[model samples]
Target: MQVQKTTIPHWSEDDRPREKMMLKGRNSLSDAELIAILIGTGSGMKSAVDLGREVLLLTNGDLYEFGKLRLSQLCEIKGIGKSKAVSILAALELGRRRKEIQTEKRPKIDSSEKAFKELRGYFTDLSHEEFFVMYLNRANELIQVKQLSIGGISGTYVDPKIVFKYGIDVGACGIILAHNHPSGNLKPSESDEKITKRILQFGDLIEMPVLDHLIVTDNGYFSFSDQELL
Candidate 1:
């Protein structure tokens, strides 16, 4: 039998991902550089880096929402074949798994960041307004998350009575309110503030405190509690 040698992977003439990772360290590599390493090569006039940048641009550079992408959606990108798409998705899946392993059994909402993480999934990528309420126990451990209403791109109606009903039904001690701004603006509109006060007032009357109100956008979240608006 003839001897055979193993193959290796690199990115471009300089193999920037590999070289930069080796010289500086893996942490020094940008998201594009890391993605290029997995994709392996260029297509047409685009380099691996260019392809990586395109993918990031599609997601607006947030890796947390990367899991929402489907194989078909990824393949729609120019020059990204099924193989390359799978490669990217597989890597993302692994990252999700690792995070899941490290995640707490019952996610405790001790801070705005945790609250945002708990509810962002529901609102991300929504093209219209949708209201969600997360019921939490006394210790702030999530009891349940629910969608209360859906509205057009403009706004959603959040009935404080209906919200109180959900919390009462779940025997929740506190509640977190969230709604998406499909326009990618995190600022709380006048309507947003008014609703928060209404819900907060009713929540106090019922003894189910409103801990936080989050306005989710494509880029990030605006937290009422964090801003002392709650």
Candidate 2:
């Protein structure tokens, strides 16, 4: 009688995810294949690639949606234990940090366009509301980016004192405030306008200019400075 080989063992060496990535390059791999490489192996009856396909299905093939998944949420999926879920989350965070570092290298925020380009990536994939501040030096170079608050999908609160305090702490001469509307609306609410004016007034008193307030959504952004609202 002929011996039967397991599915993974039967896969051609060049066709294996890790080997394929090594041979063809990472960009050549599909999303499922890349996830399979991270997952390492699969649960009962599923190949790693097959399990990865299921995960992609769960996120509707959007990597940003996948990135938002919590460890507990990921663990709920078959074949994803705590270890595997942690690996995926760690990988996603590393990618985010890498992008942040690259952006920081070009930290100039001279115009609303530049500010939007720099700040949009941080808010693009978030499911909840997050208010962030980018502190700038005298020359408009970014000193640091800090998250002021996180709230539910509808809105988040930003303390003017805390915002200025971060500016003082970072020795920032100017600052740009930003937050995302998860609903993908670029229109600023009344509260958004009120907060921007308040922060602008406070910045004037502190000698730290509020360069802009950006309302970012997945599709686009609304810039207070660009619209002469700041």
Candidate 3:
């Protein structure tokens, strides 16, 4: 059987991808339009937009996750040959590099909320236990937020040493330890008590105060310090 050709129209002032981009702005473009701008054209049967849609759906709407796929996997798309696959991958890498460069000039950790905002988006649907350490400066401004452990909803392991080492290494004057229960219970548990006591003791030795131990859930929060445990 012979393959039939599908033709794209000649570039025109009103319809050209670059002109449309300049007139409407990048943000105004649909996902397919944005991808078509990158890919330039379609193959025998499909438009670049249709090809890009297939790629996105295969990766569950995350382009970064799609980039993790092998080049052979990308080339499996009917219209995406090895060169086109490489172009897509190169575009992804350029985006990744640009983001890294923009964020690397200075690392800012302003507050516990700001430091942990990344976690909020990612953890909204988690079904297991998770823990985080928030390192703070003398003024209680955040320096870093680290995930120390993740376990089943009722169980987790967190090393006081690992948590404190970051504090000591960063010369943090204080720390706010926090974690979430997927069950939405902000109340501290026996294990939570044990870990808090151990971490507080470690902090005391180095003169780095553990300002507050907070158990925050999607529903609300509970503070051991607020309860006079600190």
Question: Ten-residue segment with the worst summed lDDT in candidate 2?
Answer: 98-107
TM-score of each model, in listed order? 0.59, 0.87, 0.56
State the number of backbone clashes in model 3.
0
RMSD of each: 7.2, 2.6, 6.2
Off by over 4 Å in 1: 1-104
- Highest lDDT model number: 2
lDDT of 1 at 177: 94
How well does candidate 1 match the true structure, expressed as C-alpha RMSD? 7.2
Every candidate's lDDT: 0.83, 0.87, 0.72
What value of lDDT does candidate 2 attain over all alpha carbons? Answer: 0.87
Question: Which lDDT tens digits does candidate 1 get at residues 1-230?
Answer: 96443122333434577777888888988898898888887687677878888888878988766666888988888989999999998987676555433245678888889988877667654679999998999989988888899999989998999998988898899999999998888999999999999999998898999999989986889999989987
lDDT of 2 by residue, 150-230 (tens): 999999999999999888987999999999999999999999999999999999998999988999987888999889987
- Model 1 CA lDDT for position 230: 78
lDDT of 3 by residue, 68-107 (tens): 6668888887888888888877886776555323243333
Report the number of backbone clashes for model 1: 0
Highest TM-score: give the candidate number.
2
Per-prediction count of colliding residue pairs? 0, 0, 0
**Model 3 CA deviation exceeding 4 Å by range:** 1-19, 22-24, 35-44, 54-131, 147-156, 179-193, 213-230
Residue 92 error for model 1, in Å?
A: 13
